[model samples]
Target: MAFALPVWLAVQEELLAYGGEVDPESPSCFDDFDDEALFQMFHLTRPCIAFITDSTRIRMKKVALKKPTLPVDAMVMVTLNYYAHGVSSAAIQQRLRLSQNDCLSIICTVSGVIAGMADQFISFPLTRAARTNVALKIEKLCGITDALGVLAAAHFKIRASPYEKDTFRSFVNTLGYTSVVSQFICDSDGNILSVEKCCVGSTFEQDLWESSFKGREMEDELHGQYWVIGGSSYNLSKHVLTPVSEPANEKENRFNQAHAKIHDVMRITLGSMKRRFRCLMQLGFAQEGSLDKKSNIIKACSVLHNISKKFSVPPPPVVGKIEPLHPGRQHSVPIQINPEALKARQELIDCNFSVASSRQDPPSETVTEEDL
Candidate 1:
């Protein structure tokens, strides 16, 4: 990830040339410059700085200043801009008055340096004590009651659909999460005395209730079948379950139900798919238009229109003209379609038609033939 040593050296030289000093109190400090100018200068020099800092001692030894290449200031400016905003080189070039090629070069070099240095910033897995501390923090923030030497089981809900509704169930006999839970218990100081290891078994209503109420007490013992945990402002109710047999058939059924729900949402809702397609199309058009400055807006619109037609969706409406509010000036407003209108149109399409096809002809029907 480290940039070439020469690139780093060049960046430092550029910074020095722009009345910038390593020390903050120096006569020629970066503070003397305006924000825009400082930003521009930083954008130009950052790549070289990253390169030099990230390079290993062995790599540094090989670097030489003989053949000077990309300016340090330009590389730094591009790199800083990229990190600040996830914009492409072409956009940076237009805004900064630099050539697209130069912008691209700096971005690539800085990216290489960042990639090399990524391991230094990435966090490692927490130890047992650290994990316990995290749990303690969560409990304190959430105001949930905790008991010492109690078994803690963590569960994850598989998303049935990306849009609308969250479905969660007790995870039983899952290898990975179960293993993690076991590790947490073993590592803790006398938290879990013993574990009842059971093979995947069928799920029963009683088992669900027990699982829900294991560590916590029930409020109403007779009719109160659920466990309530205290939240920051209120209590959250969790249904209790008894241990259930995990059968292959039951797992398959659950999986099918989840899968079917997702499929129905995606296929049946035209609004969902239409919105996704429109957003993607707009992004693609923007990228394409930015790359080729001479690209005609009309051509881009036509292409999008054709694409929409192919999908049987209506094209965005065109605004015929735009006039400037002030007279005798070149400044004029740009016309664009309203996103809300587009969404409404998509919703209408979704509600108007069913995705499933209807049967047209009957199985047993006699047709009258012409007299031959």
Candidate 2:
């Protein structure tokens, strides 16, 4: 017959009683039960002992055989936490009891997987019907009939650079997307309207200004003009706008102020663009060509010329200013005229000569016969 006793009592007597803490009233404290009796009691419960032993062995085997799955999810959580909270990786490692190598490995692997998935997911070349529907939706949202115009203006500030163009091109190429940057115009509601390649250059300031003027009823009423000036490292564009109602004397003053602002903005933008371009070149996106000071100057002049033509503005003088270091030295030297400026100066000279000759002749002098 199986000994009728609780396992709890046997365990308490075997383990807890050794600590000198026991209750005399407890069934486990029975003085009548010797070691043999207690052994017999526990032996009678053979199935329970076997079950406990098997469970422990199975757990041990699982712990030994289970492969480390990189704890990818934990790594992602840590990385995101670090980025979002600005916590150091060392702090994260300490808290999570993770080694630096393991943390970095998980982060790199997870990032690579996410990048691959993003590359795989974004499909391009949306249908014409889809584009039309998108445009219609944009129009409704912006409450404008020319929703595309709104879209263009919104993106004009963002996609105004050649760098942005190249980036978009690369992204599209990588994803096998057929959507051209030009095809995406911003609508009044800031929604991208329709896909068309023409939209790519629409964000450029010159393009936007020209389009606005052309679309407006009075093109001549627009007061502003823009020009490019100087060479690389100091290349700039100057914009001058005169209010229609302003007095003639104030026109020059307003122009000077506007030109200064234009110069400041262009200088900042060009410097930033150059830095970013250099970084891209280093990263293998751009070819390592001659970006010497002379080449930079030429490119700057070219960009200015192109921008001026697009806006129907005369090209500004691309002259480099050289300031004298000492007061005793001569004044700053003016650089040579740009090709466009030279042509303009020549035209002005020819026009003045013609005017003087016309005034002198004026059909007022007739030759008389000298022999008579």
Candidate 3:
């Protein structure tokens, strides 16, 4: 006969011995004995954990030791909690009963593994068939036609270095914190198709895009028939659209009104993304060799966002506003012009007024809001 261990001690041992995958019904130290508690702990459901574990287990497996430092499930659990809460390594060690070094190592390793596997879930659909499906869904949601996707950028808060060159930001000086800005392009359903990461705090969405995958290429690829949209901060082009600056006339006013519909779409999606991964709320301080670790975490969050959306996991409430500030680029290079792109922009404007005059919602939701 033997006495049962204390509940807390037993749970600790169970977490330490955690192997294979979690059973959804089984108890977990990460949360109370409830579904909502589990969701709150990791921002992921049981199935979501299993889904990711299956893909990442190969890399996570440690063949060198008969008994690993931590079980694979425990490693993933600790990592998710670290990213989800943005806690210190010491706090994590205390919670999970690991050394400070082990806690730090596990975070970097597991975050890298998740980012490496991003391609499996996060993707940009290049085919007409795939794009068409996205366009249709967004149209129903936003009441705009021919929209490809929503483009938006939100700054993730990070602590600046003491020397501070890497994290310096003229824009957010008043806010008193630095950031590693990331830009995201997502389908109407808020699935990330592309990500631009590791940009410093001062970089605005416009400058960021010109240096990214969408800068000049979208015009050539979109031509006149398709379009993407963005906010007023973005300079409008043939393949892109923005709200009228002052609404010089009724036509422009109507265009601005139409732009609002797309704005709501982007707002909802970006809000959902930020809310789900609160770790991104303030990604802690930036220090030497810590940039890559944080960048990988951002990518992993995006991948997890896509997964949660796919499995019908409800997105958390959208919280916070986008900071408004664009000092503009310091020095400028002249942007080149293309005749076809000019024609396309004109056609888009005309199409906008036509819908406005008709007093009807467009058949498609091509009203996107992004530079790229």
Candidate No. with top lDDT = 3
Of 1 and 3, the candidate ahead on lDDT is 3
Candidate achieving the largest TM-score: 3
Of the pair 2 and 3, which is ahead by TM-score? 3
Can you write out model 1's per-residue Cα lDDT over 171-262, one digit (the tens) per residue? 22233211011101111111111222111111222233244433233333332322222111111123211111232443333322222222
Candidate 3, residue 116: the lDDT equals 74
* Model 1: ten consecutive residues of lowest lDDT: 178-187
Q: What is the C-alpha RMSD of each candidate to the true structure, in Å?
A: 26.4, 31.4, 8.9
- Give lDDT for model 2: 0.28
Clashes of each: 33, 10, 14
TM-score of every model versus the real structure = 0.26, 0.24, 0.75
Ten-residue stretch with the least lDDT total in model 2: 322-331
- After superposition, which runs of candidate 1 have C-alpha atoms over 4 Å from their true positions? 1-68, 71-73, 88-98, 143-372
For model 2, the superposed segments whose C-alpha errors exceed 4 Å read 1-69, 86-91, 120-125, 143-372
lDDT of each: 0.28, 0.28, 0.62
